[model samples]
Target chain A: MAEKSSELKLLSAWFSPMALRAKIALNIKGLEYENVEEDFNSKSHLLLRSNPVHKKVPVLIHGEKSICESSIIVQYIDEVWSNNNAPSILPQHAYDSAIARFWVSYIDEKLFVCAKNIQDAGKSDEEKKPHSEQLEEEMLVRLEEAFNKCSDKKPFFGGNNIGLIDIALGSFLPVLGLIEEINGRMVLVEDKFPGLINWAVNFAANPAVAGTFPEIDKLILFGKTLLKKMGYCL
Target chain B: MAEKSSELKLLSAWFSPMALRAKIALNIKGLEYENVEEDFNSKSHLLLRSNPVHKKVPVLIHGEKSICESSIIVQYIDEVWSNNNAPSILPQHAYDSAIARFWVSYIDEKLFVCAKNIQDAGKSDEEKKPHSEQLEEEMLVRLEEAFNKCSDKKPFFGGNNIGLIDIALGSFLPVLGLIEEINGRMVLVEDKFPGLINWAVNFAANPAVAGTFPEIDKLILFGKTLLKKMGYCL
Candidate 1:
């Protein structure tokens, strides 16, 4: 029955998938929240005050509480809006939820950081090639296994619903696509990983997540500007 | 009223604080489980098969299911044994649980790892000095903040009971002492972090965790042997 709150705000950066996870979670919860975009170089006072631990983006503020860590924020949103119309983001079953949580934890713990490093490696950056390739291959292998293990009949990871695992992976979709675009490689090839490719396609087109992603061209251009700003690319 | 499982096995290592988390969880739950210790130099078949993602120890096998990730396994234990007569390891309230999780996550994500690197950097290793020093100071500052924020009147992070946060940090007690012994610096000095030090002492003396830790001198010797084997020390 908790459809709305007096004050719900998200401190985020447009370019971050981590931030996108919070936005997408809010959108899915059917809850109205103000999204305040942040500049990394000159972080806002609210951002610094709210998130002293990591000083990171995607800090969710609910009433007087400030929740950092995007995954935790999503969980908070799900819990606070437990009576919302949407199906439980993390399934009701404990085991199933744990599995969903494991995959979500896997995103930042291993997958996303590796993917970012791999995507950031310059085309002619020979020194970084093998390291990036190794991580990418390992990531793909795990993704392929998870894809095969989850339902092929259903459109999402949790079967018949876009559950927590779906949101966790779905948030990273734009970045995955951006990496593929920048690196000019078919990271999610149909022949090699048909199940994953199918899942990605379904996820990208899904209403909850689809609108959240920027156009591939726009994402690529934005990525370039961001990287240039960081002095990682010229 | 289920007191135990017929087929509960813990795949773990003696040296790993991560492994100890699972052991401590099992103990606190009062559920009978077998401890199958693994040799780190040559991991057992079950360790590899059960945890293909990390291929690490502390994988809990219950009936036919295998649960990996120390914290995840602990969470699973708490859920599966929810009926057991022990108080919840993670706090019951959502915000409280989130705060507990935040601290637990901070241990591995920042504090423990930085402390390890700082402890491992040899006295003559001038190249590693500045980085280790910076990370150590930041970690200490953060620890002080978390300690002060989580508890003032109680000995544990959850205020009286050894909750998830306590277990997470308690497992690192021996290693912390060992780190100080090696580096010859009192990272947990009473004046600097009195709250954490108090919690650490109370945790070590508490029956729940006391039985879980090795003797201080024995642990020191073990740490030396392990570091020597790994070429981290002479």
Candidate 2:
């Protein structure tokens, strides 16, 4: 029963969590959209034209308007089509919304860097010794605090439904799991980050999140391939 | 005309452009707030408790609510006191607001680094060579594009009044000016960045900007002192 709504197109990459954020948000809202996977080596004209600043992926085109950056795009999508029956991504209260946005920014600013470093280090044996371990310890402590902050009452960052913060952080779960699997180590284990672990499980098990998240095996394979590319493989 | 409304207090530092952003935003909004200048060496408990995550100022304390991150605090200030007579710092339109926020983020993520490099270089002879020159070129091109993007038909980033992008970028003006003064060269000349230069002049000349910005001579002194502290100068 679609009647000429604004066309939504997402320029995404399979393994990129940033693109996964856009993907999950769209699916959660029950919005019908076309997904065009961008080649990592050669970006499309649309991607470039849409996001000339960063020229990166996860560009959401709603008719003529193209919103770049995953968090920004997610907010835009939520605002533009806000009449959805799905749970509100951003909190209703201004302060809560601010807090949500802050966490989302924090994930990008802090946690993402640590995660990337761990991923890179996992690929490299020499650097993986004590450096990655130290970062992992720091990451765990921070994530523990963050989990306590976000999961004050409920399973998710916003308490009830999968909110903005949830979407932002959850997108990286598959890759993180893959990293743990490859390294034969536990990252966000239940003991240290109980709330985060529970939230991750709930997020992964959701119907909306079903097909959106890439397979763990596929991600591990990609990670291993990257390691090989970097000339550091078993 | 100060009513017993919500108590506003800004946890700030003079040398920090980020803190300066919160100051400018509060001033532009005509919001009466207490400014608690933080000593970089010994950070106050209020700043720590208020902003537990970053533990950095400017933390805007309105009542018991503590907002951290300068840009986020600026946005919060705009939203909270939105009914004020002051022109809206953020644009009304969704897309425009996104673009405004994007440019502000750009200023932080991109321009701020180049600026820091130039500022440091200005303080030392060793860094005055090709290193700072290369950074200056990059900064000019990126900033030129940023200016063009933000300014459509008006002077300020949000067009008419000083907007989010303006506050974010303009916070560095005093520091930038001091850098130019120390180097004996103009950083943002009219010819290279006419629109930006014009905007900067208008921004500095504005009454709201006055008193909030640290004096140029004092800033230069601070820069030189910092250089000395870093052992770059005798």
Query: What are the TM-scores, per candidate, against the unseen true structure?
Result: 0.92, 0.90
**Position A68, candidate 1: lDDT:** 86
DockQ of each: 0.60, 0.54
lDDT of 2 by residue, B2-89 (tens): 3243588888877778888888888887878888998767889998899877788789888888888888888787777788688788
C-alpha RMSD for every candidate = 2.7, 3.4
Question: Model 2 chain A, poorest ten-residue lDDT window?
Answer: A225-234
Every candidate's lDDT: 0.76, 0.76
* lDDT tens per residue, model 1, A33-113: 787989877989999999887888889988888888878888888887777688778777667767777888887777777
Q: Which stretches in model 1 have alpha-carbon errors above 4 Å?
A: A1-6, A121-124, A231-234, B1-5, B121-124, B131-136, B231-234
In candidate 1, what are the lDDT values of residues B169-219, reduced to their tens digit? 888777877777866777678887778888888888877676777677887
For chain B alone, what TM-score does every candidate structure achieve against the true structure?
0.88, 0.87
* Model 2 stretches astray by more than 4 angstroms: A1-6, A121-126, A129-136, A227-234, B1-6, B120-135, B227-234
